[model samples]
Target chain A: MNRQIHLVERPKAAPTHEHFNLVETSIPKLGDQEVLIHNLYLSVDPYMRGRMSDAKSYVPPFKLNEKLVGGVVGEVVESNSDQFQTGDVVTGMLGWEEYSIAPEKEIRKVNPELAPVTTSLGILGLTGLTAYFGLIDICQPKEGETVVVSGAAGAVGSVVGQIAKIKGARVVGIAGSDEKIDYIKNELGFDEAINYKTTENIQEALEKACPNGVDAYFDNVGGEISDAVLNLLNKFARIAQCGAISSYNKVDDQGPRIQTKLIKSSALIKGFIVSDYAERFKEGAEQLGQWLQQGKLKYEETITEGFENIPDAFLGLFEGNNLGKQLVKIGEPQHAKL
Target chain B: MNRQIHLVERPKAAPTHEHFNLVETSIPKLGDQEVLIHNLYLSVDPYMRGRMSDAKSYVPPFKLNEKLVGGVVGEVVESNSDQFQTGDVVTGMLGWEEYSIAPEKEIRKVNPELAPVTTSLGILGLTGLTAYFGLIDICQPKEGETVVVSGAAGAVGSVVGQIAKIKGARVVGIAGSDEKIDYIKNELGFDEAINYKTTENIQEALEKACPNGVDAYFDNVGGEISDAVLNLLNKFARIAQCGAISSYNKVDDQGPRIQTKLIKSSALIKGFIVSDYAERFKEGAEQLGQWLQQGKLKYEETITEGFENIPDAFLGLFEGNNLGKQLVKIGEPQHAKL
Candidate 1:
């Protein structure tokens, strides 16, 4: 029997636990060239909210009765293909179930010796690549320039700020809480961090932090925070728009006019997803791994212990409860390495 | 004695002709490295509206009781520098007055033999380079793709739509009036044209015109029209944002959330002034001139008859009363070109 969570209802605003239903089902037999993966971890992300609604979006809506799917690292329990064998550690778009079946072409073998299997769901995965391409390729931050990142303590933005610092930029972070500010400033070594939740005026704080004006901005949380940062952009500034996590649950748009600000300084705003740079994933991964090994980059993951807590882990993202990547550890590995 | 127009006060909304004060004054003496230009033509542009307000912008606001300076083509009536001789046709940022003095380096010599002197303020000048770089370099309109231009029959947009056609793109134009619609569709050779003033639903109209979806957008009017065009952008669409004439007089921001639409399709929107590409002006000018000579591009000028009507001409831009480049022909050319 497998415990799976289904998106039982579409949410109007911030989703509650009731929107997702936990149900039990029997694990089916694998077809030819299929691998039965015992999903050990499940990634809960803000982008998943976009998939919860039936609106036209980048990814399709999650079906009402089907298991919610996301990035997961698993151990192969049974294999009927030459590509994957039993007991192999793999990562793929698997479900929230204790057991998930994937086609041979769908899963990729990840070496556990290089790093922990869970790291594949964080620093070396979609979120990291999103930070890598969105910062370097889009904004092209120059040394000594000010680079501001919203959602500074999130899975993607944490990496974005570090990369900007490695490129010799003055990194300023905008986050929601004092703890986030402390983590980004003390642990991440960011040049400056602003707590939007407590600050009376984010614009004034940003103005003081970036006296020379922001030259590169990595936008992960768009709304008033974006408006404040946008007002401080310098000439020829570039914005790498990754997500608008703040508005992912909100029904109404809550931002000021952006065109005039963009026009005044001749700024550029480009929006993109990580899949846009799929061909360069290997390049991004290698560099991120190198930075991790060289101690220039560090990561933290907030892991929920059981499959039943998956929905709560997802809901916690909106509440800003996680310090870094949010993941739910569902099963123990069949074998351990290093 | 010289006649000049001054910005008397900033308006709360749309500027009226009364906001300008036309007065007679004495022509000032020229210092060393100066050239006295007898103004023949003054350019009327929407960008001048931005200079009317005291707000911080790309160009400084017009000083009260001072002559409003803009692009003007004139004959060198007097030359204090060896670089420019009397009788040379030149263009400079001179005033609305009949006679204005400028430093030698402040003016560029325009050969009447290469093209008409009036063209120095039109297709071969700032407006032309704006269309050139904004479309070719920024948007990169490709063959068979749908290219849409707002303010389609205006000075900059007319050239942008034509350039898209030259690039083998399926061109669509959006303007205010029926005459503008006909002019762009029949005369300018645009594949499709929409009159936003008469259309009940601009988004639906745009969707019909750009059935294949907008691959490139040249945004000159940035309000509801921009919102409609932005909603129909295809995957990886590019937008060259030149102006926001539509919002120059508006009091409030009116547009739906664009970040979601932009992120879903990985769209790119860039706002820029023509001078951003100053180093490549020569290259842009040569190509524009060649296109004119080859008859690959066509142009039209809405010339106001006298110096006294300069303010009215400038005011008329917001009314959408002109086609192509609007120029105030102040005085007869000292000598006609071939």
Candidate 2:
């Protein structure tokens, strides 16, 4: 029997435990060119909040009473294809179940010896590549220019700040807590980190942090915090609209007015999902892998355990319970022989 | 004596006739590299509204009790440099006066035979270049794609729609009056036109006009209308943030929430001034001029007689009283021999 979670209802406000249900189901038998896998790690992401609403978006809404699915790293238990044999470690979109069945072409095998298997979901996965493309392609932070990132302690924002640093930019981060602030500033080598929860004037704090004025803004947390940063943008500033985690739960939320500043500064704002650069993913991952090997990039993950706790892991995202990448460890992966 | 207009007070809402004071003053003596000009036509643009406020913007605000300034087309009456001679038609940023003196290099000499002297202020000047860069560089409308333009009968929008049409795009224009709508569709060759003021549901009207969904949006009037357009944008749509004529008067106006639509569609919104493309001005102008000569572009101007009527011409922009370019004709240009 495979344990999995299902979306029982659409979320009206912030997603609650009632919205999801955990149940047991049988693992499907493998078909031709198909592989059966035992799931090891399941990834929870902020963008998934957008997928819960039945409104039009980049990705379709999750179906009610259907099995919830997302990025997962798993160990292939049985295979009927030449692409993979039992014991191969692979990652792809899969159900929250302990075991999943998929075609061999749907999963990409990763070398466990090259890096930790879980990095396929965090630093070296979609989260890190999102940072790489959103910053480098959209913002293109120049050397000595100031780059301010909101949700600075999150999986994506943390990597964005580090990449901005790697490119010799002045990095300033905004996070919800002091510990997240310290992690970004002290551990991640950020130039400055501001705990927005304690700051009286966010605009003033951002103004002081970016004395040269904000040349590029990687927005992960939108709302009042983004409004403050918009006020401090310099001429020709670039904004990478990554996520709006803060106001995602609000019904009919309106942020600040930007035309006054955006026009006056002749700025550029572009929104993108990581898949927009799917053709260039290999290039980005190679660069990120090289950076990790060279000790230029650092990352963290706040992981939970068990397949039954998937709903809790996903709920913790809305409450800001996790520090970095939020992952659920379901089982250990056995690497295939080199 | 030169007749000119001066800004008397900053307007709280819509600017009135009382906000402007007509004055007659002696023309200043010509200095080295100076040229005396007799203004032929003065442009009244929507962007000037931003400059009327004391607030910071792309251009500096108009000074209180000082001579108002904007784009002017004139003919040289006297020259103190080799760059110009008497009766040479030229265009530059100048005071709203019948006669004025400026350094020769500050004004560019344009040929009357190549196009009308007034074209320097409308089709062949800043107005045309604005539409060129804002459309081509920002939106990059592709063939067969739907391109929706707000303020469609205005100077810049008219040009923008025509350029999109020239690129083989399906053009839909949003204007205010039925007459303006007819003009854009019939005279300007727009595929469709929407009269936003009369429409009960703008989003529905836009939905009907753009059956395939909007692939590019050239925004002139911002606020609610733009919000409607934002709702209909398709995947990877581009938005040229040209002007927010609707909200220029409102204090701290919040246009619709773009973060939601922009993110879902992965759209791009860019705010720009014409001068931002100064280096590419030559290329943009050559293309515009070629289009005008080839009959691929058509334009209209609602010319108001007399130099004293500059304020009325400018005030009419907010009221949507004019079609295409609004120009105040001060005098006739004496063209220099070719």
Candidate 3:
């Protein structure tokens, strides 16, 4: 029997346990060109909150009473495909169950010698690529310029600040907790960090942090935080609107009109997802790996053990409970040796 | 003696007659490398509203008790430089006065034989160039894609719709009146027009008009109209934010937060002024001239007679009283032949 999590009901606001169900079922069988994967690590992200609602978005909403699918790192137990063999550790979009069956085209083998397998779902995978393309491609921060990143200690923002720093930019980060502030400022070498929860005046703190004015902004948590950053934009400032997790649970989020501000500064703001740069994934991954190997980049992960706690881990993202990439470590590979 | 208009006071809300003062003064004398200009046509624009307040913007705010300056078409009556001679009809940034003096480098000759000299203050000048660069360079509407233009009956917007049509895109115009709707649809050949004033449900009207989602939006009036348009953006949509006349007077303009919508659509929004494209003005002007000469493009002018009515013409823009470019015909050329 395999255990899996399913979306029992759609969420109108913040998701709770009632919206999801844990079911025990028979392991899915493999078909032609398909591999049976024993799940090892399951990834939970803020963007998944958007999929919980039946709204028209870039991707279709998660189906009710159906198994939730997301980034998964697993080892093949049985294979019927030439592309993948049994015992091969891989990463792909897979189910929340203990076992998942995926077509060979969907899963790609991960080399454990290069880095930890978990990095495949974090720094070396979609999260890293999101930070890379959204910052370099959209914001294009020049040397000596200031780059402000919201959600500073989250999966994507941590990498964004480091990359901006590598590009010789003054990096100022905005996060929720003092721990996050310390991590981003001291550990990640961010020029400054603001604890939005404690900061009485976010706009004033941002103005003090970014005295030269913000040249590039990587917005992961948009709301009043973004409103403050926008107020301090320099001429021709570029904003990479990567996420708006702040408003994902909000029904009627409103703020001051930004048109006049945009016009006054002649700024540019672009919204994007990682898939928008699908063709250049290899290039981005290669660069991020090089930065990691050179000790110029670093990443952290908060691993919550047990598959039953996956929902809690996902819910924690909204509360700013995780330090970096949030993942749930399930059963280890039975057939594959480390 | 010369007549001059001065910004006597800055208004906290909508500007009124008390904010301006008309005074009789001695005509300005030409210094070395300067020309004495007999003002003919003075352009009254929406952007001027931004200049009235003492706020930090692209250009400095209008000084109190000082003569107002704007785009002016005039005749050179006294030349003290090799760049100009007496009787040359020219256009440049000049004071809102019957007689003014400008440095030679600040003014350029306008050929009346090419078109009406007034065209220099309307279609063949900044207004035309604003529409050209904002639409082509920023929006870049593809063939068959839907292009929406707010403030569609006005100077910059009227030209934007025509250019989008010329680009083989389906053009949709949003205006404030039934007459403006008929003019944009029948006269300018826009595929659709929404009279925002009469329409009870702008979002529903827009949806009916644009079966396909909006791909490019040339936004000249930003407020609730923009909010409605933003809701219907297709993936990879582009918005050229040229103006926010709706909220220019409002001290605290508020609206629904757009970051989530921008992220969902993967759209791009850029704010700009015409002078931001100054380096490419020659290219824009030449293209506009060719289109005008070929009769592929057309323009209208709501010319208010007399220098005394200049303040009223400028104020009328906020009320949407002008159909196209609003200009005050202060005086005709004293020394140049029409």
Candidate 4:
């Protein structure tokens, strides 16, 4: 049987679980160069929130009365092509569904022996690639430079700080809670970590943490925190704006005023969507995966059990509930069960 | 006799005549390798206004009762150096005075027969170099790119448009007056011009002018006009912030906010003080001089007569009184009667 969640309506303020409707039907037949897969895990991200609204953005908005699409790992139950056979593990852009039928171009063969299928939805996939390009390409971190990453406990932000450290830069992180702060500082090897929730003056904290002023800023949560950092930037500072999770909810009335400081401080601020670097995705994924195996890079996934809890898992990102990459585990694999 | 003007008190708002005091003294003795230059012309720039306040800046603020030092063109009356003989014309950073003494390293000798020495204060000097580096190096303009230049009829801005045209870009200029707009479009061959004074909606005008959106924005005025242009920038737009002439006189409280757009649009905004590009001065100057000789570039000077008029000429810039480059004819050249 085919069971999937469909987007019933566009979100206004905070998206509720009722906005999505689950539908059940019989499984469809597979075509040439196509494979029918049973979903294993689905990944959720903050940028997906932007795609849900009917606004002119980097990517097209999600349409009404359709299964919401996202990155997912699955096991092929049936295949008509030589590229995949029944029981082959694959990952690609699927949906919030129990089973999906897709073309060969949409799915990538996942080697379960090399790395877990769930890892393909996080560190070995888009999340890690985003951090790689956002930091190394955009920020151009150099040895001995000080790098500050907001949302340091999240998937992309976590990788950005560690990569900056690997480049010999002094890394500082800012997260919402003390536990995430400790995880990033002690476990992730970030030189300093600040709990933004408990901190009163962000500018003072930035001044205290980065005594030499920030050389590079990897912005994930863009708002007042970015404003404070902008003021404390050294001459010719570089800012790689990856995401604005903090302002993504309420963008109009008050996105932090960071422009005045840009002129006075002579800083360089650039925004880039990672898909713009799609040509180099394979290279970035390989490099990121290698770093992970070498213990130089580490990633944590905040897993939500059951396919029904995808909305909760997604909303947890905005509330700073996720530790690293946020994902929902749909079903257990044969290897795990054995 | 040598006559000098000293800054007595800093102005709270607009500077008055009383803020400057003229004093008479004996001609200062020239040291070995020093040239006694009888000051002929003095420059007035937006950056000087920043130097007038006691605020900390890239360079030190102008001291009380001290000569306000800036670009000046003059003729050698007596010389204790072989580098420049008596009656030779020169240009360099000299005090606002009737006569000045400069070391060999401080001044560059100019050929008055080729181009007027007053031009050493305008098109072929700091102002020209500012336009050269700001547009060519920082903006990195490409052929067919839509470029929007603010303060489009001023010294640096005038050359900025001409260079963009030379580089094969569709140039759009924004200026304070209709006359300046006409001059830029007619004389400089800018593709389009906007009289900001007569325009109601700058963003709409910008959209109408550059339908494809601005690929390169050379910002000379950094207040509301810049804020309007920021919205119309395309992806990967490069902005060279040369000077903020519009708000140079205002205090910190009334500053404009434009940096937020840099983050949102993923634009590259770089603030360049021409002094930072001093290493390439000779190369930039030689190219500018060549452009002038070929009749490819043109310049205009609003020359105010006499050393006593220096303060008034400078204040004219803030009031938008000067048509092109503002300069004060400090004294008659040594060979004026030759």
Interface RMSD of each: 1.6, 1.6, 0.7, 3.8
Candidate 2 on B1-338: residue-level lDDT in tens? 88889999888777899889998889888999999998888999988878889775558899988789999988888999898989888889998988889998799988878888778888888899999999999999999999999999999999999999999999999999999999999999999999988999988889999999999999888888888888988999999888988788876676445676778899899999999999998998899999999999999999999877788889999999999999988886665543
lDDT string for model 1 (A1-338, tens) is 88999989999988998798999999999999999988888999988888899986656789998899899999888999899888899998888789989999998998999888888889999889999999999999998999999989999999999999999999999888898999999999999999999999888999999999999999988888888898888988999989988888889774566777777889999999999999999999999999999999998899999989998999999888888899999888875342
TM-score for each model: 0.97, 0.97, 0.99, 0.91
Once model 3 is optimally superposed onto the true structure by TM-score, how far is the C-alpha of residue A243 displaced, in angstroms? 0.4
- Per residue, candidate 2 scores C-alpha lDDT tens digits across A159-255 of 9999999999999999989899999999999999999989998878888898889999999877888888888878899999989887789887785
**Candidate 2 second chain TM:** 0.97
lDDT of candidates 1 onward, in order: 0.90, 0.89, 0.94, 0.83
Residue by residue across B1-338, what tens digits does model 3's lDDT show? Answer: 98899999998889999999998899756789999999999999999999999876768999999899999999988999998999999899999999889999999999878899988988889999999999999999899999999999999999999999999999999998998998999898999999999999999999999998999999999999999999999999999999999999899999999998999989999999999999999999999999998999988889999989998999899999999999989886668998
Residue B301 displacement (Å), model 4 = 2.3
What docking grade does candidate 2 earn?
Answer: medium
Q: What tens digits encode model 4's per-residue C-alpha lDDT throughout A1-338?
A: 77788888877767778788888877778889998888889999998877778854446788888888999988887788789887788899898898899998889888878776778888888888888998988788889989999999999899999999999999999999998998999899999999999999888998899987788999988777887787777777888888877666663535333443555567777777777789999899889888988989888988999988888888888999999999999877653321
Per-residue lDDT tens digits for candidate 4, residues B219-299, read: 888777877788788877899987777666555434233343554566788777788789999999999999999999998
Candidate 2 lDDT score at position A90? 89
Q: Which candidate is the best by TM-score?
A: 3
**Over 4 Å off, model 1:** A336-338, B334-338
Q: Which pairs of residues collide in model 2?
A: none
